[model samples]
Target: MNPLTRFLSELQEVSLLIWRAFISIFSYPRYYAETIKQMDLIGVGSLPIVLLTGFFTGGVLVLQVFPTLQYYSIQNEAGNSVATSLIRELGPVLSALMVSGRIGAAISAELGSMVVSQQIDAMRALGTDPIRRLVLPRIFSLVVMLPLLTVACDILGLIGGGVVASSIYNQDYHVFATSVRVGISTSDLVSGLIKPLFFGLIIGAVACHKGLSTTGGTAGVGRSTTDAVVIASIWVIIFDFFLSKALQYLLDLGQL
Candidate 1:
């Protein structure tokens, strides 16, 4: 098949998988236990790394911006810049990327292994819907947990930025806090939170699709895991750009 044809075929497959998973979410014999387990794994298991990422990102932003602001004698504005950037863009984007790298790879590997082992086939043979049992819980867990993770990252990022500004830069805590208050609006917070939901969906769908499509053998599982990470990461960035524009447009409409 031509490249375009292959791409279209893959896209169709992924879309169908997402649709099936979505429908399975409301099916009888819901996998509540599995969903909760996945939530804990994806959310709680990811917390330490997420926190570290957010803290360092925030600190680095302050470090990078402080000197420039200082030169302009607007050092106090660092908090506003940091807060607005983190809350509106960096926090969600970075957090999602981190999760895509960590969780996406794991999901793909697990599912890919199951496929390679014929475990998924066996489940189907036993009249168990793998889509409902396995895929739905994962997608739902991510959809629910990603927003919460983003929020945590945002908070840690702000705190990290505040610490750097106050201690390392000798900027007053009150000034930093005031700048953040002035810079961040409800829209910024809402937009940050909103972006991660779509990101989670993308990560889950792409990862699951790659996993389910695994062939060959162990090598294929490895390839699927790697592809899942790369594709999900790329999609996160691509979707973030469009989502930002869409959210801005909606916010503008709300003002009208």
Candidate 2:
């Protein structure tokens, strides 16, 4: 009944839930089809927001950095800073946040509704595992799509930064391209790509769990939806810290 004990209990439950979700993938072919559907729902449905967010994010970064670069007389390094910042961190972080807000909210709401309707219980009575049927597909979909979505974000973000850098910042296009090429490494891009994969998994898992735990009436479903979003967003930021440390360790060890 102590706080620490409760926390440990919750942690154990989460670990078991994750294990069961992973096992469900191989145990059910229908889960794969459901996962593919969730992927499209989460990934493709997020493209508009991701593109808009990525474009403006790049534009804003260019806007912020170019003036600073000019003031410091490092105008030539404008593209270098922009490219490295986008490819290494900003692109994936922002894209995941955007998608998390969009997709995470929806998943929580849908599943919460199922719980409220007792549909989840109905499925259980029919000899189906709810985690395998509902949660695993979403978890798998998110883990698969986030990296691909991050790639799209990285490309669009770079192009947006390039446009502003050349057209407004007066940096040469070729110079910007070369600087980005040299300043951003494969590892830098990989770092950006990696965060979103984990983000997807965490976001999906948290949302689905919250949804499954929803209680009371319609009010509870709404609360669960809000809680899911807030928790998923916070988890993404928290995971980013650990991910950065891990990536830094890898880079230091020349394993990146």
Top lDDT hit? 1
List lDDT for all candidates, in order.
0.92, 0.82
lDDT of 1: 0.92
Q: In model 2, which regions exceed 4 Å deviation?
A: 1-9, 253-256
Candidate 1: C-alpha RMSD after superposition: 1.8
Give one digit per residue, the lDDT tens place, for model 1 in 7-109.
8998898899999998876659798899999999999999999999999899999999999999999998999899888988999999899999999999999
- Looking at candidate 1, what is the lDDT of residue 212? 93
The digit string of per-residue lDDT tens for model 2 on 9-33 reads 7567666778888877676446667
Cα RMSD for candidates in order: 1.8, 2.2
